[model samples]
Target chain A: MMEATNAELYRLVLTDAPYVIGAYAILWIAFVVYLSMVLARMMRLEKEVDLLESAVSKRSGE
Target chain B: MKQLRTAIVLVAIGGLLTTAAFLMAFFTAEVQQFGTVTLEQEVDTVFPVAPDQFQPPAGEGIAYVRPWFSQKIFYFHVPVAEASFLVLIISAVFAIRFLTSKRAEFDTKSRIAMETALVFVVLTMITGVLWTRASWGVWWEWEPRLTTYFIMMLMMIAYFVLRNSIEEEERRATYAAVFAVVAAINAPISFMITRVIPSNHPVVFQPGMASSNLLPFIIGQIGMLMIGYGIYTARMTEERLRERVEIAKEALEG
Candidate 1:
């Protein structure tokens, strides 16, 4: 295998072992956090939709 | 009930096959011989494997022959990568279906498949990173294959991001499906362009492996595909049930 000339770039970024692992860890954590937020918002919207439907039903019955 | 039963059966088969492949890799595969080097060489001097044993130097263009068991990563890596792409395609298919039919079920299937693809894509990245570290002495490289997979990982994440940003159910489904289809198209092009473009990265596609090596790889591939299918089916069933429950609740309220 030919040595990549740009191997120095990797060496520079990975100077600290923790940083390299941390990059991946951070990305995953962010993704999960974002997903949870989305799910929560969806649940809230569903509840609001239900409330609106119920309110309309009550008005019709009266 | 029938779909659940089918899913269970598929998962069982996948589990059995994967276990068999794992055993075959460890006990049956022949050790791949990386060429030997003298202890006094400059390359060996820099990247010493042990205090006494001669090993190739790090970052030197020397190939350290990996043990037979080291090859097992190949089985795991390729299968996960293949499965990831397969699931991506399935997601795209459902996305297209949703776009055409405007059906909730299609959207549900697309989302579940995307979720499953994410799992496999992560596995592929992990295994690919390990393989690069072990074989190439680098934790990460911007080589064609690596770069392409990296882009793919990001694209899939972006799909989720796009989905999250949308508040409306139908609009979110439509946009995510469109993105999924585009991503599915891009991944193969990424792979192809990487291979075609000339670069310094080492290509490891050997002409042929011994039967022992081949057997495990084949088993692993089949097992992974089966597992992927099983996961998709299981998730789809769960989504269907959730939709049914949602409909029932709405009906009761009505």
Candidate 2:
């Protein structure tokens, strides 16, 4: 009886493993994607700032 | 500039804390045991089956399936949901401030806050859907809490769409602010409505969560808040820098 119950408990753990792992995996992916997007936008804005700064300096020099 | 640097550090810390919480949840947290239900007959779950239904009959006749894997999701789901609501409230607060002051800076703050809120809302929805599938054995349900949350998500999307449809800057800001305030008001209603109306959503805290569960949950919540704040501040910095560039371009043209 003890051995049968132990086997049942082990099986339950295996069955539930996927759902638990999947939730954590999806959350990590979501965070990474959001971070990547913000970084990309920041980079684009940085490039724009550089161009604008150069243009302003050229205009003042002229 | 200093604010942006601080935000970056916060983001790093938040990410690390959340990762640690995830590890602790799996390694340390106890598997939840909500009331027991006995299977009357053969159920097709991968979990070990009782050799006979009558071999060990539960007193209530309802069989508690093995403590679910879905319970694990609560750690992540609850935190994301809370963070999303907090960001939305922040957005609405800024909206109210913008309306009172009629300042473009406030409008900018409101808009960036709204953007951050949208990202968190979407994450909440994704996590909620996953929980629904794992817990309720369905991918989606139009149950009270679910339906209310769906409406809240739509209102969020609508807020942005409303902003886009308008051609004038100030008019767009005003309309978006109003929508944001409405959405913010609706958020608490959507949350509390489940209390008044009988709902299927699991009330996690009323019965009490295990202390083992609470540690990771509290850690996850703090980390999520920090991450939310970091995202908002980072976006605001980028937006402000873009505005500066636009001003520079205008000055050169003049």
Candidates in order have lDDT scores of: 0.67, 0.78
- iRMSD (Å), candidate 2: 6.4
Question: What is the alpha-carbon lDDT of model 2 when measured against the actual structure?
Answer: 0.78
lDDT by residue (tens digit), candidate 2, B1-254? 77778778888888888887888787899876543445444444444443345356454223434666667788888888888888889889999998998898888888888788788778777878877877777889888877887888899889989988998999998998999999888678767877888888876556566788889989988998999899888888888888888898898888
Each model's DockQ score? 0.06, 0.41
Q: Model 1, residue B30: what's the lDDT?
A: 70
Q: What is the lDDT of residue B167 in candidate 2?
A: 89
Report clash pairs, candidate 2: B36-B64, B37-B62, B37-B63, B37-B64, B38-B62, B38-B63, B38-B64
Task: Give TM-scores of the second chain, every candidate.
Answer: 0.82, 0.87
Which residue runs of candidate 2 sit more than 4 Å off their true CA positions? Answer: A1-8, B34-65
TM-score of each prediction: 0.69, 0.87
Question: Backbone collision count in every prediction?
Answer: 3, 7
lDDT of 2 at B4: 77
Off by over 4 Å in 1: A1-62, B39-69, B199-206
